[model samples]
Every structure is written in C-alpha cells, then in structure tokens.
Target: MKNTILRFNDAVYRLCIAVAGLSMLTMALIIPWGIFARYVLGSGSSWPEPVAILLMVVFTFFGAAASYRAGAHMAVNMATDRMPPALRQGAAILVQILMAVVCLFMAVKGWKLCANTWNQFLGEMPGLRVGVSYLPIPVGGVLTLLFVLEKLFLGDQSHRRVVRFDLVEESEGAA
Candidate 1:
C-alpha cells in the first residue's frame, strides 16, 4: 500500500514536471513569434503576449509543486540545521505543518478566485476564460499538499527509486 502511494506520487511528480516544461517551452516559442510579428511583419499579434503570461503562471505554479516534492524548493534551514537532533525533528514537523496550512490556503482561496472569475473572458484571447488561466494555482496547491501528506505519513520519498532515477543508475553502475 505504501509502495502504491509512492508510485502514485511519482506519477504526479512527472505530470507536474511535464506541464511546467511544456508551459515554459510554449512560452519560449510564443514571445519570439510576438516580437517577430511586431517588428518584421509590421503587425502585432494580440493573443501571444497574454497567452505567454498565462503560460508563465502555469509554469511557476506547477514547477513549484514539483520542486517541493523533489526537495528543491528554496528553504532557509541554517538555523534548524544547527539544532540538536530532537529539536531538529520538532522544527521539521513544525515546518511541514506550516507548509500544509499554506497549501490549504492556496487551494481554498484559489478555487474561490477561479469561481468568481469564471464568467470573465480575456480581451486579448476572447475564447479563453480568465478562470481557466488561474486553474494551476489550486491544482498546484493540491499536488503539493499531497506531497506534504506523503512526507508526514510515509516519511521522505525523495530517496525512493522512482523519484531518483539518477541514484538508481549510479547504483547499477557501481554493481
């Protein structure tokens, strides 16, 4: 059962990475086209700038969730690292609890924001709803929350084989 949950988280982590990467890639493609269209083609495209901005939001939120799971998120641990083992453990629990609270706030408030904005459409991209652009916030919050729960209950899965394929390769090479 623990293995199943870890596998599920691994899949989620991959998905988050994929979404963030695609968003970044698409944004990279878009901004250049917008610049080219304005300077070379003598006409600016209306959709590209707004679309790129939306993509940036998507990239940031999804990438953050994946970063959290991978233990790559920015954390100032110098103070905690200096503590005794028992104090360090307590501090770690406190940090996780704080993380969980922040995640819940993001999920709840983000959903409310989405719902409130659902009726509005972007002027630059008429077909796209404003709410749709904000979807990543709640989604990312939920994903990060899941990772937090996994850590609290199952312990850190960052060392698991599925999460760290590079470690597996290194072990195989040594063997």
Candidate 2:
C-alpha cells in the first residue's frame, strides 16, 4: 500500500514537471519565431514576448515545486551539527514540519488569489493574459507538502554531512 502511494505521488509530480517543461519549450519556440519574423520579415508578432513571460512564470513555479519534491532545495544545517546524532535528527524533523506548514499556507493563499481573479484578465498584455499569478504558489506549496509527508513516511531526518575536499598540487613542505 505504501509503495503504491509513493508510486502515484511520483507519477503526479512528474506530470506537473512535464507540463511546465512543455510550456517553456513552446514559449521558447514561439518567441524566437516572433523575433526572427520581426527582424527578417519586418512583421511584428502580436504577442509572443508577453506569452513567453507568462509561460516563464509558470515554469518557475512548477520547476520550484519539482525541485522541492526531488529534495533539491538547499539549506545550511551547521547550527544542528554540534548536537548528538539522535537530537540532531529530531531537530531536523521539527524544522521540516515548520517549513511544510509555511509552504502550505502559501499554497492556500495562492490558490485563493487565483480563484479570486478567475474572470479577470491581465491589463496591457492580452497575450500574457493569465488571470492567475498564483499558479506557481500552489504548485510550490503542494510540492513542499508532499516532501514533508514523504519525510514523515521515511522517518529519517539525519542531516547529510558534506566533505569539501581541496585539491592542490602536492608541494614538498620539506618535512
């Protein structure tokens, strides 16, 4: 049962990522076509640039959520480093829960904002005409929540120890 849920979660997450990626790819192709036409053929595109920006916004938010799901977000844990291993893990879990709550709040707020402007359109840029700048918020929020829940399921919160190695040419110190 647990494995099934994990598989479903991963599938859903990947779908979101694919959607975001397709949007970006389309935007890139469209914008370049617009630019090339305007420059070479001397015909201006009706709305390529604005469309690109809108897609960019979507890409950023969705990408962020994807990153969170993959555990790609960064944080410093030096403060917890000195604590005993057991205590350190507990502290990390606490921090994760707190972060999850904050993210959930943002998601709710963002979804509300998106809902509030359902019939509205962006002024001055019709091609950029998305009523919701709030899409990314929910995406990020949900992803963060998923990550937190996954962490709970795993029941491990040990902070990874990173070893930075300095590679330098070996010079004799005359020992």
lDDT of each: 0.90, 0.70
In candidate 1, which residue pairs clash? none
Q: Which has the greatest lDDT?
A: 1
Candidate 1 Cα misplacement greater than 4 A, ranges: 163-175
The estimated TM-scores of all candidates read 0.91, 0.74
**Each prediction's number of clashing residue pairs:** 0, 0
**TM-score of predicted model 2?**
0.74
Residue-wise lDDT of candidate 2 within 70-161, one digit each (tens)?
Answer: 66767677889989999998897888789788888978988888788766777646533244655777776887687677767764322422
The window of 10 residues in a row where model 1 has the poorest summed lDDT is 160-169
- Distance from true location, Cα of 41 in model 2, Å: 2.7
How would you encode candidate 1's per-residue C-alpha lDDT over 95-173 as one tens digit per residue? Answer: 9999999999999999999999999998888899989988888988999999999988889877665656565468779
Q: Which is the leading candidate under TM-score?
A: 1
Q: List the residue pairs that clash in candidate 2.
A: none
Off by over 4 Å in 2: 124-130, 155-175
